[model samples]
Target: MSTTPVEEFEVIIVGAGIAGCAAAKAFGTDGRKVLLLERDLSEPDRIVGELLQPGGINSLKSLGLEDCVEGIDGIPCYGYGVIRKGETVEIPYPIDPETEEQAVGKSFHHGRFIQNLRKAATHTENVTVRELTVNSLLREDDSDKVVGVSAQSKTNEYFRFYAPLTIVCDGLFSKFRKEFTTKTPDVRSNFVGFIIKDLELPLPNRGHVVLAQPSPILMYQISAHDTRVLVDVPGKLPSVSTGDLKAYLEETVGPELPESIRVKFIEALQTERLRSMPNGFLPPSANQSVGMILVGDAMNMRHPLTGGGMTVAFNDIVLLREFLSPENVPSFTDYETIAQQMNSFHWKRKNYCTAINVLAMALYRLFAANHDADLEVLQRGCFSYFQKGGDCVDGPVGLLSGLIQRPIVLIYHFFAVAFHAMYIEAKINGWSGAHLSFIMFFTVLYTACVTILPYLWSEAKY
Candidate 1:
């Protein structure tokens, strides 16, 4: 590892995740002196964020990384689907095939995406890839204005690298952000997965979220024709150090997956455990503190559902590029604040994801529920809400997307539901409980039948 500060490093980006790399690349492309740091020099391994949303493609195209992005063999995702109560509604991606439809299904391997982005960042002039483990921030004064970083290689002397502005892209649990700013990660992550890979499994080209049974399993095609299953199993979260991950892989995917995929997945889990970086996806630029700006998981951590994480990082970079574009030399302090307004899009989607995630989990639990009575309650809830387009006030998805700026709109969704639920519950009579329960239960079955029966009759309009 090289020591000594190069005259003036404009931006020091810690962590080489999508957000960090993109921001560095942007600064570099503008010909600014930048340093990109990574904890492990080795390539990133197994992780989620495999399904790149259509919106991700749109973002990448703007960054000029879209064409080669597929060079990583990312499988393009169609759209979202839900399998609830043994019924599945697979939404065929609504892209017009005449244009970029062919490229639309490219699903990104998170590790692969990181490698590709790192390649682009390092190759760009003015960007230096610092392969070392970051220990702490380089503060100029006691106020915590991040002037640079303190880092070291495996067995090398420690070095201090300085920069006027430092961007911490250090995944989630960002020590940098906590040290400098007041932005706390308020997002609570609930789902964890047993990710296993195999070559070209015999599955649909489109993605499927199987909530039909308990412990929701989300399967999507990945970088290779291989697939990754995000199986949501609940109980005491298994220990990571136990090497329990390998045995867990066998029990979860071996029996359910096809033979070839099963074999491949086994080999991957055993050999591909990421001993390096933390197992989480990247995020957009979040907090802006004086000389430090928090990007990726260090700031607004994304939910894995929509697959927009990496692309959002790219979008953040574009913003950083524009801000640092020599034509406009805003103070590094102002740059931090501007990064937030620039990434309003990501936090917007966070709002949407928060609710849909709840919906997905609740639906998964209902699908897996063996108790018929409790299930009836869930069934009624789902059947009524979806059919009515049950708006949770303004709805979380809208808020997360930044479409609805005010968070208070999410509260309205609750108030509306509260009133409606009260009216329904007040009307509950003796066996009417049984009757209403029956109606709720049957309606789901009926909706399924209607969707199926109409297509059978050639009169179904989805």
Candidate 2:
């Protein structure tokens, strides 16, 4: 009987998605031998992860992978245009205080950007990307420490690859996250996607968010000729196989869109095959496993409403590179040092992650009010707050765009929106009855706390 030999590497990254590719390149650039494994190396056709916020762009540049966003027909996104009822307000990203230039984000075909990242990783000095499916993590015989992975090639040949450190980047449907953490993703909604060709948007070079009934609808150009539309559908989705989804979009969502966009939306529905992805909320937990760590969607997730997933992922890579640098830890074999660093990495990352996570979930709840009177009032207040335009617009949009990392700022603005909503409500009621106004104030405040507190607590624990 012939035995298959075990191939060894300094680092083995499972899943060549955004986090895996970036991690491989970072470690390889640091002079470590890296083995990057993926099930497929072809361009991916994903609806999400196409939008890169300004902070994500900065992180990519920091990692010297800025070239990945180039030559991909990527569009520059300045900010967002929000529409409520018939009123529209444009919110542009705040200018950088240091550079004095407005921060710009990029929107491209998710697959194209990913392929570019893969190419960058492949070209790195010590990184070797292989097309393989990782079946499971290989553990030490007498311990729970992961030493490597068991994977299979396209031809069905099984092989064991060894490494001192194994990084799991298998993404949203990660099969390995269960081995390290007890948390599961809470999927409350799904995004139904469509591509409209040569569509003219109300606001060019910026994302347009329509606060439509049931939930929010997003439209942004991915290339010169194509615009991507994602409609948020909460709870159980209608049967797509039976045309219910199509009917729902046409009869329900289409009318809520602007006249300029509604025509193209209907056209796309008639011509394109609709694709949908679930919007999940998964809070980050510290890594307790010794030999392996989780990154990207596998480690954490947020609602896709803010387009902050890639921003969080790239920023995580930046911090991971720093925490695991040769200067920080001379060798990967130092499990004790690595464990301590992992704990620090978990908490330190919350500086940015917490804001994005809490905002995404909280905004989704407010935007998709679902006939909740309190949420509806808060939603109106939120739009009105944006209309105030100054610190109001800059602060909230800054958090959404990934340029701001202050959770305190987020908390303040959230409650401000609540109070503003209360004021608006009181005005509508004529402010004539003092008793009614006082009762409504506490009601709105309680609703605001209920909306954001749980998400904040989630970030605080574990």
Scored by TM-score, the top model is 2
Prediction-by-prediction clash tally: 22, 0
* Alpha-carbon shift of residue 339 in model 2 (angstroms): 0.5
- Candidate 1 off by > 4 Å: 1-7, 96-105, 180-203, 212-214, 223-225, 239-288, 319-376, 379-462
Q: What global local distance difference test value does model 1 have?
A: 0.55
**How many clashes does the backbone of model 2 have?**
0
lDDT of each: 0.55, 0.93
- lDDT at position 404, candidate 2: 92
Q: Put down candidate 2 lDDT per residue, 1-462, tens digits, no spaces.
A: 222589999999999999999999999999999999999999999998989999999999999999999999999999999999989999999999999999899999999999999999999999999998899999999999999999887788888999999999999999999998999999999999989999988889999889999899999999999999999999899899999999999999999998988888998999998999999999998999989999999989999999999999999999999999999988999999999999999989999999999999999989998778889999999999999999999999999988999999999999999999988887887664766567878889998999999999999986
TM-score of each: 0.68, 0.98
lDDT of 1 by residue, 1-462 (tens): 557553457788888877787777777877778899898857776556566655456556666666546578766554444544434444444434357342244576677777887888888899999788889886776675667778888777577888888878886667666664454543323344444554553335666655423344566777564566665444444566876644655676355544544576567666554222222222223354567766666665434544445554555566556655676665454654555554563454444333333333333344444345445444444433433542531243343222233434644543343334333443553335566566544644443333223222221110
